[model samples]
Target: MVRAKSIDHGIPGRGSFMPMRDSIPRRADRDTLRRELGQNFLQDDRAVRNLVTHVEGDGRNVLEIGPGKGAITEELVRSFDTVTVVEMDPHWAAHVRRKFEGERVTVFQGDFLDFRIPRDIDTVVGNVPFGITTQILRSLLESTNWQSAALIVQWEVARKRAGRSGGSLLTTSWAPWYEFAVHDRVRASSFRPMPRVDGGVLTIRRRPQPLLPESASRAFQNFAEAVFTGPGRGLAEILRRHIPKRTYRSLADRHGIPDGGLPKDLTLTQWIALFQASQPGYAPGATGTRIPGQGGGAGGRDYDSEPNRAAVPGGRRYGPTRGGDPCAPRAQVRQTKGRQGARGSSYGRRTGR
Candidate 1:
């Protein structure tokens, strides 16, 4: 059974006995603490509660990362059945244990990535380390046991993960495997030593069935690697060099897809079509019109036939032209040498006669 401990109210001014406010607990020295951890602590009590609320479990077993000075840890211990915190800094871990000795909090002094997740954790909640947030998240996803997670991360990362369409590959790939939502955006000032940028809380729940097949996982990894390296080019072009031409051509032809590749807005069906088309004997139609399930016609309306197609200057439509700007004033060529001598001679002879 977990024990409860009296929260150390070190603040002076308030009466000897005052109830702890759910607001952020003031830090003794925020700047120094921030310097130690390379980040500020989330001191807002309301934000902490909101984050904890997002966790779906009954809070029987919870994992907290980077529980700095027990800012969020204080509130978590009060609400949860058992809380295990992973703190890399030994000093902070010691302080946490001492501060919440009687409380139902266990402190593990190590990096979260290296530490083994405890068995049977119903929920995982924490303000993840900024330096290794993605690695930590990936680690969590790899673990099949946890029911859900609520994490406070860099606002940008959170936004990318929860954003609609054209998100990062990490976000998009994992999205199919998990449900991600933004709970709230915590202000930068909410921390003891405020961070330069604001942070946000993201709630992610595992999907019932994994999105990609085991065989496809490696392929997806390779695909993502290629796409990120050359984001502006067609997906097929980027992938062609890494994969076999036959495989690439088969995928494109079978889908009746253009070699130009998938657009940023390509749907899951389009992706599946490409996969299907990669099979043997796929022929893309010559008309270059995209027909659903037709395998090789262009998929969208052709812009090449648009009326009032802007003409290129110098009558050169597709390539470079031979002339200069048509709008500029033309320069007159002055007669020199022989022409000037002839004019002068005629005037001299007429004058002499």
Candidate 2:
């Protein structure tokens, strides 16, 4: 069983959404919060299928945060046994209830942050507001339940969380306990009201074997925070302040750290090693095994997976092709350049999104 570990932490859609418009939402807002909370809702079928496809863990129940307009809910009910959706907007909450009255979905009208996640909830999904993404992530990580997640967040956040470009303090700290992956990039145009930055499908799954015990998570996070915020020119100086030069050299050589690798440079593997070494008696866990496809310290980012497959609700072909399950494979078509027709959406089955 995966051990539950909590850490202090975004957001996709805002908890309190704005009043609906005659048409799509606009820049005009009675309350400044309307825009701040993330009003852009997923409108593209490909993105919807991709987001649902990346969901991890095995469970009949799913807790959906901010089911705006029931775009995701429509497809979720078809596959999952039970779908519990939490929406901050009363209008949308009521709408979702009426929309899926017969479906196996429970609608809760309140802030997801305030709602208590059941201990048995194994998975959660959402298209969160980029502003509060970090805060929401903290809540999920701290929850006593929930094993996997599929979220639509800012592109940069998704990239950093997956360590596709490099590693970050967030990924470094959580990497030991969870596996993050980037399924695909959601273009801003895919949403009804386009957002400034494009969205990315980010998936998170609890590691089957944690590098450290649940009891050590708090201390380990603190150590990681220290190294990240500590004053030092490079990782060498910062890490040297905590461990002996001998141990530092050993780790550096093992991980092949360059002369002046910084704290952010360390991958999940290096972070685990450093944390374990800091303990009174250094020892290795049975499952420090590296994740496949993630060359070096980078995350396993799956931007492309399979040649192409049908991904649409029912048997109807929505985009490009249609036949098999909508969430079966990652396939979306898009031109890469200055002015493309529409944004491409794809999903992949891997450790990262």
Candidate 3:
């Protein structure tokens, strides 16, 4: 059994990342506080109540991320059969452990991305940090053993994930297996140290049937990324480099895609059809040839081409690493308090497909 350490109120600012020792000493210094800004603690009572309600634990096992000060954790213990919290800050972890020492709460102190998901975890919930919201969502979507998740993330992120403005590359990639939705909007003032932007309660549930076959996961993901981020005037031009423009244009017309429209303009079902038709052995006149490194296409960038492909700014490469794709397991948490406002502010804006 893990022993809870005594609380050290001397430390001024809340602990953020991995401290020097397991028993982290609290210091309210400006520099220390700034480093830990990514681990903002949720303080609003109303927001806490709303988050718990959205979770709908109902006797299920819940895994809460960054349970700072135990605002939500307090309610989780009452609703969940077992509540496991993964906190990166040692101080906060200790505090949670001590607070719920006799309850069905397990506090693990470390980076959540690196933490293992137990076989019994049925539900996941958290008010994710602005800097690592994308990474966290990707992790949750990819991980198994969790039936559903209710997360508090940046409002713009919630919008993109739910395909409000236009489908994002990441959202499009995952649409085959997971369904995402925006449940409620949480104001910026709901947090203790108010964030510049508002928050949203986003819920993600796995689909009973995936749109694409499991074998096509890799090809589908890469294809979606290239189409969204690849250089081109529109979908036609993007595919023209790999297939004949006439063929692509005909397919686009058949799918009701407007001329000169970008990839985001198409719906999820349309993308699936396009990807299926673009495979290497596609039909003679109607279907277009596939691009190398894409679905069922000829050889291109091998899995081991790069140990860890660098992450594209505002974009992420998720799923299991082929070789040691450095960007596969995004470990670094960004500080979102600088000139850019939030570190991943780019993801919030409309993606220029």
Candidate 4:
């Protein structure tokens, strides 16, 4: 069991408040919430404390994605001067409003994806519902107001987002500006309604000095998406035929990338160096080359094609284009039928959002 610790911030007449240990709704209400939201409430005080610690809120304004019953929200109010929670469930939003009524808490009942984040908000923290984890994450990562965020999500999702073992295209696309870390994994038993999978505390902090400028962010994203979805046997092999063969060989030799290495297998620094090397003017004679036997696509695939029409090597496929808000919407919403992070659900799993 994790131990819950109290924090004192020397604010007169202002402090945090937790609903009575028994104040949560009865089992019947819990069941209804579960059905409606497709999520289990995080009830462990210790886990809440752990999440707060991971957030590193040092008096900055915070926007919490979901505050179901205010377990984590209570801690935020104590640590930060402003705590605004975006809750999808009206019942729980009303409950949290009444609980933190007079304090710095502002509860808004709405989909976090559609809700406009405040200008002064500097940090985001929450134990977000698993059902909409992908959507919420996209919204947060795309928004530029927040400098850091701590999120509690499904274990595998956390691991992938943090780029454990290998990186995803989404992680690679954003790695130029943000840093991801997996703090700890809480067991499924930690929540009031145990999830089939454990939960992980993940944090994302923007770098003080980003490697790539914001002006180049879109180019970098398009480059990453192209590379990940480009055709060839492996990353090195793909590069060999995609770029000028001499330049590709030089990069491989300089970076020590083996001929059979995959895109996901490359390190963050290597990916940066590679992207730098692939720029139009960075290296001369960098027009793309075609392999004799390979199918035609060295950045030739249209990003706006129909679903599942464009397939890449290694069982990877390019997703369809999202029309508006490049930051908020994914390149593609993989599964339209089920909630993301649901049991056996693959919604947004392909994009690794």
Candidate 5:
């Protein structure tokens, strides 16, 4: 029988591409897949509850990216009024759909990246596929639809997004709009196939008072790219390319940012001050800023890519473009904290898409 893949998402091997093979899924045992992909799919019941507990569903619907085995989906339906899931594996998509037939869950069998995010989906929660974590996050950050997301991503990713030790290129690009925080750490043992790295719970909440206008996203993304990739060891020297040394010195004096601070050490406020001080005078068609390594040419990562049709896949869409590329969303949700996820064992199945 063609059983579903492991808990999280399939472990994709290095330099090895796993095709969706919607028409012909080769027969293989679960262990063989683990050996082939090195995937860490989430399956631990306690971990599932823990992951869901981080989501603050304030009377809004929840959209799950990859409801592998439906463990997290099960917990979500118990508290939220409407639950929507996108599973790429045909068998598991059918399986998850069957499990929640009567509940207030809407199961769509399709790639989350290609899927058209439904309107008014305020909260997005998932044990995301590790391979395309950055792409998936970029997709989410590009859209102004949802207000918050609670995700179980790679440990390093969690810390970086939360800006714990230091910020990453992606995190710095989005810092003006969202607030990232890292919660608990999930051990490798929590997964069925047991991935090599541990998972971390991360929460993303939109800022009520954005330092910059949403219209300036394109310019800001480019501005960030230049600063991060600038040719200097310290920010003071690097920023000299954008702003005059006199201005930077004055700002540093006022903000208390060390003159020798590295790019990673910049806080949100400091970054905003630097950008505003530059006074790029953003016009409608200003040079499109791209997220470094996320796009091409003079411009950076372009948010205006192919539109999401929200089409229903007849068969399963395995790993083929499983992430990246999502359209707008419906509404917003105010992330509510301190709510423990309710337990569930309805369908009783653990193996998932």
Candidate 6:
């Protein structure tokens, strides 16, 4: 549970104090506030300064979330002409109001996601709550109201959000429209009552045009989902299940692909090529061989070795090989000896052994 500190108005350089009638309860009063709200405040002065520096807004309208203890709020007030803060904790909101007082800061005691962004706000900045960070980001991304945003979030989440190609499906889906990059990492020890995990700051810039067409985007998402279903299965097997068998064969034929199938190490481009070739009436040149159980020519010869040998009918010798090598001579001799032994002494007496 997060509790907001009491507002102290008389302090010099501190902003005006405004108390919320329904502010978040004090930690001492109720421990549940922090637990439920995920309010881990940013207490490091250097980190606060770095976050402000990364935002780099002067006289611009800024929207901030979770301004715990006024640490980040103070900086925002100093740098931006109009800094609007939405803090769930009433005490913290009061502290921010008193600290910034007559300066350019407006403290709103409410949930950030529910709060509306002021019109014409160009920049959004906050040390966002970890639990709702994804939702908040999605809201911001979906809204065209802000020009850009700088956010401080959990290091792992930030890494996934900003990572290339290897990021989560959500990140990949959104990548075409927004560019996310990490600015720096803030140590866990830097925060007061330090959090268990470290933090990172990231900047996001929205793009004007998406990378893929709307139709292709859906297909790509479906493709990604199918490929990542199981860890050990080959890519070809997965694709074959999702795509039509005839379609698969046709694509293999058009692209000159081997009957076997695509290899596990096939690149993204190659996968895309295979998908493209599957489209009606497309063919590619054959370049690679396919393994059995995936796709290959008839005869089913072992690609890497001689055909497996099997036992011959009514005899101990094995079947003949294609190379004309009969069963080993030792095998024939062993068979003859076994037959003689079966005839036993009776035959030996009759034949005058």
The best candidate by lDDT is 3
Residue 10 shift from truth in candidate 4, angstroms: 39
Expressed as tens digits, the lDDT of each residue in 96-215 for candidate 5 is 766777777776654555455655687999888777677567656655556689999889889978988887667777776677999999998888677788889999987655545544
Q: State how far residue 302 of model 2 sits from its true place (Å).
A: 33
lDDT on C-alpha atoms for all candidate structures: 0.56, 0.63, 0.64, 0.64, 0.62, 0.56
Off by over 4 Å in 5: 1-39, 280-353
TM-score of 6: 0.59
- Candidate 3 lands at a TM-score of 0.73
Q: Would you estimate the TM-scores of all the predictions?
A: 0.61, 0.72, 0.73, 0.73, 0.71, 0.59
Q: What are the runs in model 2 whose C-alpha is more than 4 Å off?
A: 1-33, 283-353
* Model 5, TM vs. native: 0.71
Off by over 4 Å in 4: 1-33, 284-353
**Model 4 residue 27 lDDT score:** 78
Q: In angstroms, how far off is 141's CA in candidate 5? A: 1.1
How much is 147 displaced in model 3, in angstroms? 1.8
Each candidate's number of clashing pairs is 11, 17, 8, 0, 11, 28
Over 4 Å off, model 1: 3-36, 230-232, 239-353
lDDT for residue 263 in candidate 1, whole number 0-100 = 39
lDDT of 4 at 308: 37
In model 5, what is the error at residue 311, expressed in angstroms?
A: 30
| Runs of candidate 6 exceeding 4 Å displacement | 1-19, 22-27, 56-59, 213-353
lDDT of 2: 0.63
